[model samples]
Target: MALRAHVGKLRVHQAASEVAVESVSLARRFRGPGAAERGDQLVRAALSVTSNIAEACGRGSVAEFRQFLLYARGSAQEALSQLDIARRLEPPMLTTVIRRLESRSALVIKQLGRLHDNPPRQR
Candidate 1:
């Protein structure tokens, strides 16, 4: 099967993709001291979440997929931490965006956990 078709079947992949997009949007909005560096970290972590999920889908077995899901979950956590740090350091104007990203990251983590706990049977 095609890579996109395979990945499209997983709900976790969709959630992770949304988180990545939101992270990029949030990072673009960042400004002020240290904003650039923090934004870079946030974007990288967020992207990693989805990238790992995609890697999971491409793997040969359920165990391999679950392993990658763990990586994705860790990246999600990293992104969430970055969001929290950004919320503390950034101006009040960015609170809403940061909160939204945090919520999305949490969802991705939850979805990853579900997949990791009970991975689909390998075809």
Candidate 2:
């Protein structure tokens, strides 16, 4: 796949959007000491999940896009880590949301890995 073609996968956007949504929901549900701080972190990570992908897609080279995907993967891990903290602090309701986000992040990671491992077609 070409860089654009790989990034064009709707699953990427869907996964990111779901993370963003879950972050919002988690933010609302987890309201305790330092909750605001954790919520903000989750939000940034969620945004990074998609923003990095979009930025990579607009880059001139496949290597650049792969770098961005790497960043996005890091962000996903960050978000998941935050979710684990939230689970420890908040009610179980947030657990379900976090799990969903985790699954989505895993899927995105798979896609990113595939894109990176497979060479793009030659012109």
Candidate 3:
């Protein structure tokens, strides 16, 4: 089906950008009047994760890339905290979406750890 194909494309994602897109969508669902502030914070943190990943991978050295990945991982953690705060206001579908994004965040963090622990050999 179409939904499955779209999800397959997401699985081919790079630089954590796909997860950022999901977070932005999740943020939009919080447009109810009082939710703007928390939503803004969440969006910023989520966007930072994507940008950091891109910046990290662009760095000249493995050490530099690892540093940026640490920053991305930190932003991901902040996003998770914000999600916890906003969970009370959201309906269950939004909660499910946030959970998926959170899982992606965890994957990014774990992959970053692996890269740091066993960096790619440069000839």
Give me the overall lDDT of model 1. 0.85
Identify the runs in model 2 with alpha carbons over 4 angstroms from their true place. 1-3, 6-8, 119-123
Most accurate candidate by lDDT: 1
Best to worst by TM-score, what's the order?
1, 2, 3
lDDT of model 2 at position 12:
72
Clashing pairs in 3: none
* Ordering by lDDT: 1, 2, 3
Estimate every model's Cα lDDT from 0 to 1: 0.85, 0.75, 0.69
Model 2, span 43-105: residue lDDT tens: 898888888877777676777777877888888788878877877888776677777777777
Deviation in angstroms for 97 in model 3? 1.6
lDDT (10s digit) by residue, model 1, range 1-123: 222226788888888888888888888888888889999999999999889988988887777788888998999999999999999988899999889878878887888888788776654
Q: Model 1 clash pairs?
A: none
TM-score for each prediction? 0.91, 0.84, 0.76
